[model samples]
Target: MSVFSARTGLAAALAVAALASGGCTQLRSHQGYVVDTDLVNSVQPGVDNRQSVLATLGKPTLAGQFDQGDWYYLARDSRNLAFRNPRPNAQITLQISFDQKGTVTAIRRGGLDQVASIKPYGKKTPTLGRERGFFQDLFGNIGTVGAAGAGGGAGNGSNTGGGGRDRP
Candidate 1:
């Protein structure tokens, strides 16, 4: 075979291989805090306070929402193939509880087992009030605005006719 035809065949093979491998590639992502194993383990309860912990591990990913005493550091590594949702391969959730005096009281660690997946029921959220169609909603208040017992009537009820004074 001539060198030009051979090179064309080789280029076609490489192109096909590139397209095939593209779908097999794994995409990885990291979210939230970046953790250091030694630094996280180095934090000792009763010895480290909020300031010391901040200096050691930097700021936490999230702090206590309500109590303001607990700090949480989260690190997650997720991977996914083409056209697929990313799944967590590894996750670290470190919770450091502090006392009212801002001293570290306890340290807790969690993993992927703690992750919860929540799916909503449907596309449209169910509401409490009566369901009205397009025409009903558009013309729902047609006669209710100035009706007799509904107020705003013409000089009939005490609420509609009287202008800041009581009439006997």
Candidate 2:
């Protein structure tokens, strides 16, 4: 065979081999799903048991901590190329808690799709004294005598308004 034809055949063989074996490529099926939301909502505290919950929902993505009897079903969608920053572009975490009697007690859903981030509420208090911008400190604050004296006149105020470029 000509070298050109032989090289073409070799390329084809390598492509086939790559496809047959799951080589250096992540083949995506373009699909993902969560268990039925309706079915999950149907659970009640008094009626549900640990065994029945497990049977209905299958293995949880996350188990409880300190034997809190909680189970989590997490589903996340994020777009990140290999070796790229992978922040929580999108995420969904469903957590179910059971009483010691193994009955459902609470269910919580958290995801990035909402405006509120998944921050623990009581752990940190919001700081009201964030740093102010230079312009805001100049304009919004008029009662301060030290500030007014510093920029008393237009000559010393350092003309912070829009520079009139189009006007003569």
Candidate 3:
């Protein structure tokens, strides 16, 4: 190849590599609650009531399932590359529990270390029933209907006036 064409090919290869690298460095996104440390620190246990907590930290992401006095504030930042699953970069969970009087009793903070991943046991569950193969299931009842009909009429034996009964 000529000197000019060689330099041009090198430049084109470099440009392609730069574009590929750019796709890998994606922007991270902050999802759910945004934590303000100063504001969160302002909430004091035993001193802050439910209303004060709400005013200071705004609303919580989740409330305690069985108890109305508990609140949970969750936040996470995730980074995703091109065509890849987003991975959690940072996570914060603040759990605030209240007393019967609606005053803050306990406050706890956690990070990604508290996260748990659970996997399913299997794809299909074993059920209780007669197990039949594909062909048995498809044609199993084809010849049984006539035999069932000849055996008995599976209906209540109540007599109707239209069926050879006298009516005044």
User: Which residue pairs in candidate 1 collide?
Assistant: none
Cα distance off (Å), candidate 3, residue 22:
3.0
What candidate 2 gets wrong by more than 4 Å, as runs, is 1-33, 113-168
For model 2, residues 57-164, the per-residue Cα lDDT tens digits are 778887878676598887766554444534445566778888887888888888776525464669666568877778987796575545545655565545656684
Candidate that beats the other on TM-score, 1 or 3, i.e. the better one: 1
Residue 43, candidate 3: alpha-carbon lDDT: 89
Pairs with steric clashes in candidate 2: none
Those runs of model 1 whose alpha carbons end farther than 4 Å from true positions after fitting are 1-17, 20-24, 128-130, 152-168
Mind giving the per-residue lDDT tens digits that candidate 3 earns over 34-67? Answer: 9999999998988999999998999899998786
Q: Residue 138 error for model 2, in Å?
A: 53
Backbone clashes, candidate 3? 0
Candidate 1 weakest ten by summed lDDT: 153-162
How many Å off is the CA of 146 in candidate 1? 1.9
Summarize candidate 1's per-residue lDDT along 1-168 as a digit string, tens digits: 699999999999999999999889999999999888899999999999999999999988888877756899999999999989899999999999998888999999999999888889899899999998999989989978878777576647455446777777
